[model samples]
Target: MSDLAHLPATQALKLFRTRALSPVELMTAVIERAEAVEPRVNALSETMFEQALEQARKAEHAYVHGEPRPLEGLPVATKDEQPIAGRRASDGSLAYAGHVADTTHPVVERVIAAGGIVHARTTTPEFCCAAYTHSRLWGITRNPWNLDYSPGGSSGGAGAALASGTATLATGSDIGGSIRLPAAATGTVGYKPPYGRVPAMSPYNLDHYCHDGPMARTVADCALLQNVIVGPHPADVVSIRPAVHVPERLGDVAGLRIAYSPDLGNWEIEPDVAANTRAVADALATAGAVVEQVEVPLRRADVMRAAFIHFGAIFGPMVAGVADAHRDELTPYALAFAEDSRAALARDGFLAGLELEGRIYAVIGDLLDRYDALICPTAGAAALPAGEDYVDTKLTVNGVQLDHYLEYSLTPVFNIAGRCPVLNVPSGLSSYGVPTGVQIVGRSYDDATVFRIGAAVERVLPWPTRPQL
Candidate 1:
């Protein structure tokens, strides 16, 4: 049962098809694993164990009858921020603490249609506003590698579950690196598909930088789940027509021209993270890909400024609408974000952000034209304290102080270039035991190239699925 909890979805499906494993047995193992780790990590916002068991029984019958569906019986941990009809979608906010979603998000609907059981819904920061996963509503989500550090946010719980063997596969949404950052910190694989590659719930679905994708232990496992979740839907107008399928066996990266940037222009990175990024570049070069260190004309401040503008213009106003009615109930960080957003929006920050985004993309587009893909460190440092406050906290990388806690992340830059696909794959583990990762940024809307590079990286540097939890 314990070993079953750690089986990858691809391998588990093989076992299920051969009648060597039953969905009931797999669900029971995952339920037990979740129980064992939830106390330590607080990854799950809610659990549907009995419902999952019922679904697993149905899946078991299907397998015996030779009528198994895609992802039949597989356990999926959904992010709490996404709606799952009739379930509580608190989104780590006190304002909506008692709110039940009336409709399920397209991603969750697709997961169910493909026969994936939602055993648990994972935690997120308040409205998923912060980079680290601690919120007043769900407490802190700790990393499996080092419990004192965060699993990484927004999708922090999803990443934590994959690392702790609490779930076979999980869902994640990236708007400014939510999915990738947590995956990088936890030694998991997270894909931030190009904008509209997967359907999303509005009004965020309309936002160009937002994406919902898959997270898993292996790149192939991630691809398997992605195939089930992606494709256009009537619910989201922005969803691209004619869904793209990512092949399970993305072959080697030979004769490919890849670019590596240590600093993406101006951001301080920790020594361990820098070394691991370089190691990955070297490994890719040895794998027959032409990996070159190139300088990208991007400044950390410009990226941060643009991200804040977008957040202020879109997410801030939405949050403020709720906070206005329940000001006393909101978290301090959420409150501050609401307040700061008003100020930024008042100063024409949103328009300025749009202009800067064009400038940033000019440089990125040129690089993509010259190279097949670009690789860079996912975050400036490894996981920070699990309970760190985003608003008041300060991060110092290589003796230099970051302007904001979120400044340590190198993900939002790609969000500024929203059309490109990005995948975060583990590079190495830090001295503290937490893993470091590199992002494979592909050409605009060219999702397969990033996965191909990620698959090659995985082959060279195989990562362990679960930590010593």
Candidate 2:
């Protein structure tokens, strides 16, 4: 059960094509594995096993008789935040517990079209606005590696499901490290395509910081799903035209100039995270790439202020709209996010934040000009405890307490510079027994370079694809 359930999507597809592995067999293994782990991980919000098995049967027949699609016979877990038209879409909140989606999101649409079977929908933070996953509706979701810790969010469940061998492939979204943080925590690979690379629903599609991408146990699988979900869609006016293609096989990072930042010029990272990141940096150097550890002079305060101002104008209000008269039903983190953003909007207008974003990017843009990509810790801390909401708390890293948890994460800056594609790959496990990762940051719209660097790192320093449960 563990072996079949943990088969990589790439391997599963080949076996399916050869008729050596039936989709039904793989799907059943995954379902049983998911059922077995749900009590501990709580990664899935809902399951459609009967429907998924039926779909897998059809997919198996397709591989035997008809032409198989790219993700044919593979089970994919989608994030619950995306609607599936009439399926209950609870954004991890009780306020909209029974609300049904009117239309399917483009990301899910593409996955289904590619013959990917969505066996389950993963969990999220309330309104998909918080940094960690937990809600007043769904019970807490824990890390598969260390049940006491978090798998990161707002794509916490996707990360968890992939780690626990419950899903071969999963969809993820990123706006300030939602995808990467969880991926880091769970020891999976997650990609945050540069803004506009993948089509999204309205409102969020227009927000540059928001990105819908892929998460998988391997880089090739992430690229496989990313290739499916990317490209322009009629529903998304902002989706980039003439889609950028990610190659299946990326070349070595040899001779490429890569810049490395330990703290991103600000917050102090945990020793575990810093050491693992340094190991990756060292691996890159050994792989024939020039790895230069450099400083990026951007204060944590300004980056947070700009992000808050933007979120306050949009995400905050959106969360509030759902919590309209039902504010009391919102989770503590969601409420805090809304209130904090409301205050930010009141304190500083959107234009001010836009100006700050430009200034923030100016520094990053200048630095990227000197290198092929920037390497840094995905999150300053390696592990976050499950069921713990730090809404009014501070965490320490490397003997220094950070101002806020967000300050420790280097993700928001990339969101502020939203065009930069960031890929988070596991560096190694932390002393806490959870995963730590480094972000391979690419220049604006150069998605290929980041993947190339990620592939190089994966080759030089191969970590365990999934933890033994």
> What CA RMSD would you report for each candidate?
1.1, 1.0
* lDDT per residue (tens digit) for residues 325-382 in model 2: 8888888788888888899989989889999999999999999999999999998888
Candidate 1 versus truth, CA RMSD in Å, comes to: 1.1
> Can you give the lDDT of residue 182 in candidate 1?
97
- The residue pairs that clash in candidate 2, if any, are none
Residue 207's lDDT within candidate 2 is: 89
Predicted candidate 1 versus true structure: per-residue lDDT over 1-469, tens digit per residue = 7788989999999999999999999999999988888899889889999999999999999999989888999999999888988888787888888998899989999999999999999999898887889887888899999999999988999999999888999999999999999999999999999999999988999999899999999888899989988889998999998999997668889999999999899888999999999999998998899999999989998888778788888888988998989888888888887777677667766778799899999999999999999999999998878897766766887789887778899999999999999999999999899999999999998988998999889888777777886
Q: What is the lDDT of residue 143 in candidate 1?
A: 98
